[model samples]
Target: MAKCFPEPYDAVSESKAELLLYKALAEQLGPDYVILHSVAWISRPGGSGPREGETDILIAHPVRGLLALEVKGGRVSLDYRTRTWVSIDANGVAHDIKNPFDQARRGKFALLEKLKESPAWKKLGIGRFNIGYAVFVPNVGDGDRLRGPDAPAEMIGDRRDLSDLGAWVGQVLDYWSGQEGAGQQIGTRGVDALVALFARSVSTRPLLSARIADEEDVRFSLTIRQAAILDILRRQRRVVIAGGAGTGKTLIAREKAVRLASEGMRTLLLCYNRGLADHLREQCTTIGGLDVATFHQVCHRWIERVKAKNGRDLLSEARANLPRGDEFDHHMPMALANAVDTLGPIYDAIVVDEAQDFGDEFWLPVEMLLTRPDEAMLYVFLDENQDIYRRSAEIPVQGEPMVLDRNCRNTDAIHAAAYSHYRGAVVEPPQISGVEVNRLLASGIEKQAALIGTLVTKLVVEEGVAPHEIAILLCDPADRPARERALQTLPLPATVKLGRVEDFSRGGLTVDTVARFKGLERAVVILWAFDRCDVGKDRETLYVGMSRAKSLLYVVGSREACDHILAAQT
Candidate 1:
């Protein structure tokens, strides 16, 4: 009978296996055993229909009256902890199966009531008959095994030996029949009354178990670049991340924060600029629940509620708690001393963004934030090339800084141009494709603006790009006037602005200085009013500016200005 049933029994094969297993059992047990296939037992009082309950197989012998058997064909492994038995394939992925032990228990009670309704039981003059249950795993695997402790009416083994199974079923039936009159009688009641009793009993019994099958796929460690960064954060008590523009320092810091949080460690994410800090906060929020705040906010809160052993009353005072501008540049060690006085007894983990813009004075407060050396409490993210406002030396700290060269957000042409412009710098371009970089020479600011208008029109009308995708950058802060003049002359409806806002949501070109648009990116980037004198100082900045474009880059400047831009690329 087992041989006739399909191998690797799925939904289509389930009915076939049930029929085969029942026929074999009936042929061995004779007419005394009343066989019931696909018997659904709904434990809910008012529930109706076949869908209300789970169905398997049930058998009732006359002398050994009511019995239930749940059948399956395959290898099964039960996780004792989760109380789940998982079926596995050749590659070791889990196959789904209903819990046989649970099915048998439910079927036993349901069949007991069904047996009491029979006319044969009345003719036999039996007040109450015995009830039995069993589960058969037909094709057991050599390596597969069960995990949970054994239970009554739960039999898990091969189904091929029907004779031995029949004998076991008879024994179970005889045991229950002997104790029938001794115990309390299950009243001959309606389906509703029986269902109510079943519901109460089920609440005490375990429902279903969960399990995970062992997989064969090989797992690997992090890449060399990722490992280098993780190693630094893991080893150092306090360290700063400093690198060239587009090095992904902030991304590394964010990834570290997430990893530490997942490990149940308390971590704080800090950034200097509000825009960058807002961006970090949004990213953290998307990652679900995590503790993150800006540096100033953290300091304010700490000052408000000093609870640690080294807490000070000075932090509780509003005027004494404010961060002064002068404290930003009073040398590294002295700055550390002052900051330590203010924000002492450091956090468990501190992650700072835009570390380069922070002066030597910043490190003073940072040093005081380290609560332990071996526990590793501080991490900083910075881009050295983006430091256009400060002249402070890079704070020398422990930990080998990891460098990320992957230009994941830009095209190959943009990366190539960026690398060519900053030749000796540590800007390693990522492997990518699809973009064009062009250097257009104009007569002056007026002509540069005119050329930019033409390029924007071409990118929008001809290339089918959106206006919001275009960004016009000015190396000189004064070049904003020329950019605005160009916007006024263009036929397109758009506004020039220093940064984005809610009102300027979409379908408009934005114009800003290179420094102001440092962390932003666009689809098309146009640079206006470049001069020969600004070439060397703006080399790295220009690289960062051009790389912001996803598909196109247009640089409009005077002949000499254009020559300098083109020459720097070579």
Candidate 2:
């Protein structure tokens, strides 16, 4: 069982006779031999007679050195008068082909010249070992017809010699070994050197830009996991999609919205994150029937419409009556429901993304906006583990939920760090492998902030990363003083400045809270977890920030916090 260069060889030639001979040789040869199919070579300038040629099959034998075989597949013959070779295929078509004997000789000499330049071959003293050339006409039966001045009957093989090809090969090797200093042993080392010199070794990492492009292409390609979700959406009018982070819920929601809008259904794609809504708006603006907005944005629009239709200032009236903390959160959704009930339905279908973070009161307004409250289309995509807002992930819809647990956004390391606090259905990690999560330990917030500054400089200036692709997320954004100190104290490049998450496309790193940055992703993320405590409330906050990074992630925190994470993971 000889090992071929391309295992499970497929013929590249015009005829199948070469495949037949390849099988015969591969089966007849021993394990010590290597048969490379269709070995191509280019002669160095001022080195060999022929410029370039391809050897049908090159055999590397430890005992007999090297052998090149030129195989002519189909009915082959020679025109005696003009001394030219002719071939006729099974289609009754005649064509002229180069003499296989001449091809074999050129290929043999070219290979010999190639090995002579290899330092390993020269040092091993097997550079000038016996290199033989032979021709094989698999369709031809009579060897006498191929016998000529150049094509010796003993050196060539025909149809009768197909069986026991090893014996015929030995006969060819013996004929070439007659010349002085022709038969030399090529040990295992020589064969290794030959393979190495021909098939060059690659020992370098890929470019970051190339790696990013490749991963993006693979990541975005529609998988059966997503298609099945869409198929379910088409069948069911009301559905709930439950999954963990990176399960592609947002993608599924967007696709559903586009299909509904294309069918001329007034469609609304709604999400919790303002930045994500802005991004979706830009994408869906050209669409005639589609509209994208945040939950609050939709609430405000309907509230204003109610005021215009009827002389009712719902927002001001509700603002005065509602509590200080619940002023905007509770009233907007309540007011939106009142406005929609009075003003009637505004959309045929509504697809809600990041439903885990939306207030429980928001679902009433969402359902009321649909043309048919009970019969119309309503799809909710949520990740229970990503409920960073501490709200009850409630949707007053019917039936069981469909889950997408195969994570496809963040890298493997990022997924692990984020899912550490996850408490739901098991989530599969991203297919792409990445560097380990960077864990930097500092004593306090000031030290961690300074370390973040140094990391920003390195990632931007030294690593050639675009500033806009970077983001800094805070776990404790309610602490206004800490947020300001972290962003101002960082020693970032002069060209790189801080901007809001939604409006940083021009040039700037996005600075936002982890909860606000949900449903959005960045190529690079620096999570501000300096004061991260092992509490249930802090669980999803850090997970949201960790999962937001697609390519790179840096976790800067206190020494105690860092030790806790590392030990727990270990």
Q: How accurate locally, in lDDT, is each candidate?
A: 0.54, 0.75
For 1-570, candidate 1 gives per-residue lDDT tens digits of 221111213113344456666666655665444444554431212211111243355554433455566776556677667776777654677887767778776667655543343333333344544565667665553322452455443244354455465776666566556655323333333222323222111111000000102211322223346445554454355566655544556556777776544333456777655545655665567443245665555554554454353454433232345445343254233433444565555445667776766665556565566554334456777766666655474554665655555454456777766656554436555555775668777686667666777777777677767666677877667656656766677665343322332122345566876766665566677876557446566675676677667567787777777667667555
lDDT of 1 at 546: 71
Q: List clashing residue pairs in candidate 1.
A: 83-209, 336-364, 346-369
Supply candidate 2's per-residue lDDT for 203: 20
lDDT of 2 by residue, 1-570 (tens): 887765536435565877888888889988888887766643332322223456888888777777899988778889756889888888868889988888898888777766664445667875457778888888888856778888778877889998888888887887888753565678788787776554322221111222122233333544457655775465477789988877778777877787666544678999988878877776566777889999999888988888888989988777776756485578888788888888998687799998888887888888889766766678888888887677874687778889897887788988888888788888888888999888777877778778878888898899977777788888776664776566686767887878767556545778888877887777898877537455466787777778888889887787677656545445
Score residue 499 of candidate 1 by CA lDDT: 36
Q: List candidate 1 stretches off by more than 4 Å.
A: 1-224, 227-244, 286-346, 370-374, 394-396, 421-427, 479-482, 485-489, 494-504
State the lDDT at 194 in candidate 2. 70
Which candidate's lDDT is highest? Answer: 2
